[model samples]
Target chain A: MGNVGNVWAVVAIALVAVATFSLGYRGSRHASTTQDFLVARRTVRSRRNAAAVSGEYLSAASFLGVAGLVLKDGVDALWYPIGFTAGYLALMLFVAAPLRRSGAYTLPDFVEARLSSRPLRRVSTAFVLVIGVLYLVPQMQGAGLTLGMVLHTPGWVGALLVAVIVVVNVFGGGMRAITVVQAFQYWLKLFAISTPVFVMCAVFIGSGGTHGGESRGLAEPLPPTFSAPTSIDVTTPVTLRVVEPVWLSAEGRVDGGSARGPVFWGPGTHEVDADTKLMFPGGAPVPSVAGTPSTNAEWLTPTGGGTSDLWTTYSLIFALFLGTMGLPHVLVRFYTNRDGKSARRTTLHVLLLLGLFYLFPMIMGLLSRLYVPELLVTGKTDAAVLALPGKFLSGTLGEILGAVTAAGAFAAFLSTSSGLLVSVAGVLSTDILKGRVRDFRYAAALAGAVPVVIAVFVRPNDISMSIGMTFAVAASTFCPVLVLGIWWRKLTPAGAGVGMTTGGLCVLGALVATTVSGYTGNWAPWYLQQPALITVPIAFFTMILVSKATQRSVPADVNRFRLRMHAPDPLGFIRDRDVARFGTAEERARLAEGRHRR
Target chain B: MTTTEQKPDWEEVQASPDFVLLRRRLRRFVFPMAGLFLVWYLLYVLLADYAPGFMSTRLFGNINIGLVFGLLQFVSTFVITMLYVRHANKNLDPVAEKIRNEVESRGEEK
Candidate 1:
């Protein structure tokens, strides 16, 4: 099925964009000055803020990539969503209230204010930008994959489309718009995603969930089979493994040579070149993409996911759990809470919303194994959520549900892109481009264009793995300092700077080594893939040891700062001095008065 | 920004008995609880990674110990949230509110 764009899906996607834009335009009335942005933040109650956080946090990775991984690897893939959600719990317990009360917005801004070190601020900015930009690549890639699946266009078209939309919205300079639009997206996604799954479940029960009235065993010791005559368009070169010899029809390059139309595969791997088409008869065992488990029993086991072992699994857990507090967009949004208590409450609500939302994607992933296992064969498991709706239902009803999933997927790309793009732009304009020029709308556009351009050059098959790299960076570099800075009284600026620099360089080296080596398999060295296990502990120790050596440099005002950071908000000790550090005379006065009122 | 030689209000509040008690109570709840959850999650990950047989053992129809462990992560998270909220409301919020009211009425530490 090539280039068969569903009209219903296209229309539904358009509706989501229109809805987002109109709501943002309405919120623009409250967003003129930077102070007005703070007002908009404080005025939003925890429930709405939580929804917005849930909306922005659930990117294409959570929406599509998790299901894709589940399809490729078996029970092991459940850890992706669980790790993603568990991070918020750690944040709520440790970072939320204290960071909010500290009165600094971004992680870079927080460290700069807390430590009074300009170099550290610059280091922090590099991380925020690197993590922000690197994270955007997967979202764009997922968008490309989704559009390629639904609209039947080339991949680059979807990446470019999202880049332009996010840029224009941010250049308009209305954060109130993003907050309002993102909150609405949460419910939109929840409804759109769950409806098709619920419908499919109902249909499954009515039909007895079996084809030809046979009792299907989920754990049968054989590879999946095509229940019908199926044709698949292979967009990329792949090495597929067949469990047994079978006769098939082909229409493109096969086995490293040009082929007009006939195929027979032996009991091993066969190479299928890019832009090939293959036809399989009913009851043919699926020739799955190489490097994945072929049988149900293998898929169901935890260790059977190709390259997973104890070290990699535990390291991945560190990246997911400790990394939440270090994400710039997520941490910055938490600061928008009215106070520390409000921040804690908003986080709790976010945990609930995310916990409930993850269940649908997990369910969809399980259902995909039954109805859309061919996706595994094509290495396009990311499209399982969107395509399952069409595969299971065969009429206009299926088309309508496919449209809803497409719309939900589009919203996932849009909301996250907007948040991350604005964050990168804000840092660029403030720190990098300061005093160079007046307009930072140029910075916004610059930040917006870089990721899609990179996405065009490289298409990593696994979106979750790409995001896991960012999480590792966050966990290694910043998770160390944030945990230490808040609790360790003797942490000096020099120690923090050195520790962060060391951690960042180590993780970057691993990233460079892995990319240059061009090894993307489960069997690659665990240290290269899961560097956080080593880097995080090193980051913490460096900070502690260096602080011990530089004992005299601890700020004399540590007690005062701790009091302001940890005291109850109703006591009102903080005077919001961060505004004075980087605000206009008028804005500073307004912020002081605002704090006084609070 | 102020670097005063004379003790500031922060020092007074930091030394106060109520604030001391408050810090002690807050740390007691947060540190051990954070440790507990982290340890519990670590155990689950270890089992999934090292002890695959235990995790993959079929518990019922289409349900395995692995799937149940994964779902229990969600259930444990929800439970933890409820526990923290309840603990804070009952033990922490009242004392914090009382301190805030006293400080506000008395106009910044005496």
Candidate 2:
């Protein structure tokens, strides 16, 4: 089937933009000072801040990639969402209260303030840049994929569209606008993903709750069959591996030879060139793609029945569980809370919200198996969530639901990309541009520009895998420093720097090697693909060993610093008493005194 | 920026019995709980990775042990968070506030 017309998609995109900017404009009224731009003046309530965090954190990875991974890799990919939400649990337990109480606006700011070292701050800023840029690429790629499916336009159009919108939003009103905009986006995404799934479930149940296909026997390795006459237009060159000789009506290049109708394929890999249309009659089992399961049993197992699955699985868990605390955009949100208690409460709320949102994607992924199995051969499993509405329901209502899912997908890119941009711009403006609002505008431009350039050049094979790599890097590098610096008083600046550099370089080298070598199996390929399992332990040891070796360099006031971080804020009383203006002069004096001790 | 250079009397506060008690209480809750949660989470991951047969074994109609384990990750997180909040409020917060109040009130005179 051709894509739904552009009118609905354009309207949906316009509505999301109008709603986002309108909320931002309202929030901008309160945003005047640099503090307002950076941390929303520390005035946001726990519930609102939680929603904003959930919104910004979801990104296209959760919105589209989770379901996509589940579709392609089986139940094992459920770890993506589980690890993602559980990371917050780790944050709540270890990082949330302490980081908030430290009173630093950015990760770099926290590193510098905690360690009393400007050089460590510079190292952290570099990581913030790398993670921010790496994360931004997938959001851009997801945007391109969505728009190409919905609008029938070139992929780059959607990427450029999101980049411009994000830049303008960040330039106009930094963190203040982002907070309000993202809070709205969380609910929008929840509604967009769930409403359609709920509707589909209801319809399925109403229609006897019976699936539309015959059950395959346990001994069968048969490919998935088209329940109806389905015509697939290949947008790019695809190589399909057939298990048995099958007949198909074909037009354009098939097996490097042009044929018009009734082409036969043998039991081997066949290349279908770009713009080729392949028509399969009813009950013709779909051809298997090069790297995906062709049967239900294979799709249901978590490991995809591969030898390297165990190592990769543990690595993903390591990366996601530890990585959430180090995300620059996520860390910056805690600074918007009124205090440490609010930060903890906000994270709790975030855990709940993220848990609820992930459920819908998992449902969508499961439902796609029954309705959109052709996606296996197409290698567009990412489109499963978007394609389900149209495939299962054949009417105007289905088209509308499809449009709504597309809009929600766009909203995902917008909210996440904006959060990342604001964070990157906040760091750039503060460190390089001296924290001026005008300079922030320039930083905002640079923040969005670099990722857009990368997105335009590199075509992502799997959006989720790319994001998982970024998480692995973040987990390996920053997770060590934050955990050690907060809990260990003897952690010197030199140790922190060395640990971060070692971890960062190792993960980066793994990423580079894997990308260059192109997934050559064996020789510890899974370790390279998911580097956190190896790199995180190495970094932790390096930090501990280096800190032990350089105990004399530990900041002398580390005891006082720990006291400030671990202490409960008695001013929480004043904060509750006066929500609007709670950062009192007395509290400032106390903070100033505590800082002096450090 | 200016706050980084100050020198408050941290040694005095760290020596106080109240501060010592507060640290002890916090460690009691944080270390054991953090350790427990990590072990639980790691067990789930290890089981999923190594014991795929156990994980994929269907416990109900199309509802396998793996899916249940995945959902429990969410259930357990919420439960842990609530438990920690309760534990902190009862055992940790009052003592922490007491220490903070003592330190801040004294620092004000300087």
Candidate 3:
């Protein structure tokens, strides 16, 4: 029965892959020009474009990672999803229309357009590469984990397979194709998550239910070990040194504690708490436990801390809310739309789609707490979602559920990686390689290869942590650039160039410090992991101060550019007559033929 | 091609009824609502930070103030979105339509 179920799971994954490739190939037909390849000729519907945005945004981090975190950590993990979805709201309010209006293909393009500086563009391009590669690592890692769980293959093999597929898809069709695949994947993910949850709920309710009934011994006080201080920042790698294995009951209370509760361990619990000091792997000391028993089990539980862990919690929230605006993949999707209004509408759809999808993962996390508490002890918390089907139902139903999850996991990886590749390709072609398509394709392959190598070698401590690191880098650098460039018209090229370089360097420096310092008792542990609390404000202030100092350096065309951005384009804004003046023979012929036909 | 034509200031352009109504509505309601929510979210964060005891205070069986605050962050997002959509539909949409008509007519004349 397990074999049959596994075969079905494999088949389902194969079907999804084939469908995705065909869709991408079909999209390539429409992507003959660089513009079409980059932004789908800027004519995509707002609704579909929004779906693609949300779809790409919902990575392994959202689907499997958050659920796993919730299963391991408890209610505190809910913040991850909330922060992620709220990012779209921020994007809607601040970024959507202005970004579309800028008429730039990539973030670097926006930098150049806003500051009119090639040097600034180069700096932003470099940041994009770093941020893109950072983001790509988690997606690759998640792909490996998901494939390993679903197909019983080695994790590295799964990672390589996903990297190859993503590279091909992005190389073949570019942004246009990725948009279609992402939109489709969004719905696929929604169904994948929702169906099993609905089935599990029904099955649980039908079989002499465990609903709303507090089981006896489930009210024990959490042990000191369970309540020990762990590094909360998602961006920095957490090194959990288990001096001893701390066993807890399903209720997350210490197993041998006088106050008995439901014991949680193995695959079900959201977080694993061993008698270990959680720090970065290199030996930096994270926050240590103050030996306080949490008042609320839901809050005080290590994985399920109530909002008391301020730095970790707020840093995460800040990352999610502000991070969306800076994400290259999500931003590039907006450029695919027809105009500013379309971009706005697309953002609205993304909000709804993402909000709906978040509900299931939260529920899954909560359910895992109740059912699969054993998995926590194994420290294989990521498998919480994949393990759900077998725990709830057996035989054919279990296999089907497993297959659906596997497919969804792969979808999460493929959609996100493709989006990242497109963004990377855009920066390479437009900024670095000077609009050369062939060179851009080579860059795309290189981009995919770099992350795959990183994934294979580094093998990040956790998926959520890897994603958070990417967000810190993004929030520190691109977030400041986009925000300042939009609101402050006085922004000079030198100022922007300086600000971006500073912000990017600060984030990179922090990342390096955190990585090299490891779990040792180093000051870098606290500061470097959550650098945004410092670097973001610094970037903002620097940009403003620099722009003020260099106000006169602003070009004469600044006003004209602002007017063009804010005002609606006039009818025949780009007339054939205008192009004819600068036209090659082929363009002139096309214009003359169009005029004669009209 | 009249590059020398004096461009009207935003204030003068906004003196039209359509713009006036939008400006009033945005100031009186939408802006205030957004401000209030932003404050609430910030307060929640501050409390979670400085007043961990307060955040840790339990409300129901195993439910703490921090959990409620975190959940409220989710609720507030939906609330703001719904409020925005309602405002756009009831107040902003008509004004926007009028502006669109004016802009379209002006474009046609050009």
**Candidate 1 residues A1-598, lDDT tens each?**
3222389888988898888777877776656655333225455678999999999999998899888888777777878888898888878877788778777767887787667678889999999989898899999988887788777777888998888888777655445678888899999988888898899889988888775442235677677777677788887788898876778899899998887777888889999888999988877778789878777777777763333566677677788888887887788678678887778788789988998898888888877777777787788888888888887788889888888999999999998988887667767766787612233467778887899988888756488887887888888778888878777778999999889889878887887777756645344465787688888888889989998999998877777677666667734445554465445777666665444211
Alpha carbon deviation, residue A224, candidate 1 (Å): 1.5
lDDT tens per residue, model 3, A116-145: 777777888888899899988888888777
Task: Give the Cα lDDT of each candidate.
Answer: 0.78, 0.81, 0.67
Worst 10 residues of 1 chain A by lDDT: A33-42
True-contact fraction per candidate equals 0.53, 0.51, 0.15
DockQ, each predicted model: 0.46, 0.43, 0.21
Question: On a 0 to 1 TM-score scale, where does candidate 3 land against the true structure?
Answer: 0.80
Kindly list the per-residue Cα lDDT of model 2 for residues A12-32, writing each as its tens digit: 878998898888878887777
Cα lDDT for residue A512, candidate 2: 84
RMSD of each: 3.4, 3.9, 8.0
Tell me how far the alpha carbon of residue A492 in candidate 1 is from the true structure, in angstroms, after superposition: 1.1
User: What residue pairs are clashing in model 1?
Assistant: none
Return the lDDT, model 1, position B52: 79
Candidate 1 TM-score over all chains jointly: 0.92
| Best model per DockQ | 1
Candidate 3 displacement at residue A563 in angstroms: 2.3
